[model samples]
Target: MNHLIRIIAISFVLMPPVFAQKLVDPAAVAPEYRDAAEHRRTEQLRQRACSLKAQQAKILLRDRAAFVLKCMDAADASK
Candidate 1:
């Protein structure tokens, strides 16, 4: 139908947003790391740990956010 074609065309024109990875602060980043030469080191370590855990567990893509959040929480608690 013409209407269906028009709707599809509109949908194609209004494309879904692309996702980008942004830098995030570590939940438990130490004060020492804040002013260090490598300020992002703590967050980077947390991110690396989270990534390793996710990969080791073969976590689903949709569940990565929750898993990373919980992992950060645990890391924070350890401090």
Candidate 2:
């Protein structure tokens, strides 16, 4: 009863995270769309760079998203 409930709760808590999106493989895409795939890869790199900057700056979790968004926008605007 109680033991079973505890085990269930523990299992749920320990479960690995599941990502909703799958990574795009550029090689798997058609040659015509390779440019689009490259763009996606570049955006992913930009996002990872922003995330690293946020972590290095020790941004609060609440403000980190906004910070990243602003960073990305700034990057795009400069292009």
Give TM per candidate: 0.52, 0.71
Name the runs in model 2 displaced over 4 angstroms. 13-23
Cα lDDT for residue 37, candidate 2:
91
Q: What is candidate 2's lDDT per residue for 1-28, written digit by digit as tens?
A: 9999999999999999997555567899
Cα lDDT tens digits, model 1, 1-79, are 9999999999999999987565545445566654652556667778778978998999998998899989989988999
TM-score of 2: 0.71
Window of ten residues with lowest summed lDDT in model 1: 20-29
Off by over 4 Å in 1: 1-37
lDDT values for all models: 0.80, 0.91
Q: In model 2, what are the clashing residue pairs, if there are any?
A: none
Please tell me which predicted candidate would have the highest lDDT against the true structure.
2
